[model samples]
Each structure stands twice: as structure tokens, then as C-alpha cells.
Target: MKIKLVAEHIYNQEFSIERALNWILNSMTSEFCMRFFHEWLEIAESGTQQLTTPSWKEIIELKEKSFSKFNFRFETNSKDKQF
Candidate 1:
């Protein structure tokens, strides 16, 4: 995603970051958004570089941690189990 943005000369374009971030925030579920906000706050308070130029591994780790509280059911055996 970052590569595509950079390749298209969209990285530093005016309001690009805000637009992209808004899109991402809008795409997320409320639960996921809350989790992401808490994690981001922790990183901000900790003065961590993980929020900037994160490596793929760091990104994956962050994602996993953010989702750790949720229990996902992939099977559609019941009507209520539908995503």
C-alpha cells in the first residue's frame, strides 16, 4: 500500500495523508478502531518509532496485538455466526 502510494506520487500530496487515514478509519469496525486508537496512544506516549516507518514484522506484530482481544469465528454453521 505504501509502495503504491509512493509510486503514484501520492505520498506527500496535500490532504493525502488525512484522506487516506480517514478512509482507513472509516473502513475499520468500531471495535477495531478502538483497539487501534488505544495502541496508537500507547505508542505516542511511549515515544516509540513503531508508529513511523514500521518494518513489516513490526506492522504484523502491531496488527496481531490489536486483534488479540477479539475472538473470530470463520465457520458459518449458524445464522448468527455470519460476518
Candidate 2:
């Protein structure tokens, strides 16, 4: 869900949609998608994650292996969402 929204927002243009999907897909932590993303890119001159086809198995695997951390900032009235 998050990926879809973020990808759409980032790549609102049809021309850039593929690029946006690839970025999010590569950002994922799955052995399958991680490797496959690269392979797909290698085959195609440009990269796209095939977002139309959702792979549940790969998503679960990515979620399980998702240990990488990213720093993000948030604004809140009570407190700043600090890292």
C-alpha cells in the first residue's frame, strides 16, 4: 500500500512510472525481488519493477528480511518525530 502510493506520487508521469517502481522495488529487502530487480533492469534498457504484478511471496520475504534502517523526519504538534 505504502509502496503504491509513494511510487505513484513520485512517478506521476507515465514516462517515469517505471523508474519510480524500480526505485521502490530495489529499496525492498527481498532476496528474490532484490536480485530480480537488477536482472530485469539488466535485460531492459530501463528498469521497472512490474508493479502491476504483485508478488505476495516476494513481499513477505522482503518484509522478513527488512532490517535496513532509513532516517526520516516528521513534524508534529506535540513533538518532532525524531530519529
TM-score of each: 0.36, 0.23
lDDT of 1 at 73: 24
lDDT tens digits, residues 15-71, model 1? 344564564445456657678778766766665654455457765666677763433
Which one is best on lDDT?
1
- Can you list the residue pairs that collide in candidate 1? none
Backbone collision tally, model 1: 0
Alpha-carbon RMSD, each predicted model: 16.0, 13.9
Q: How well does candidate 2 match the true structure in TM-score terms? A: 0.23
Query: Which ranges in model 1 have alpha carbons more than 4 Å from their true place?
Result: 1-28, 48-56, 68-83
> What is the per-residue lDDT of model 2 for residues 1-83, given as tens digits with 9 covering 90 to 100?
76456534553443243564465556654645566655444434432444354357655554555444543322223242221
The lDDT per prediction is 0.51, 0.47
Q: Which 10 consecutive residues of model 1 have the lowest summed lDDT?
A: 70-79
- Angstrom error at residue 61, model 1: 1.8
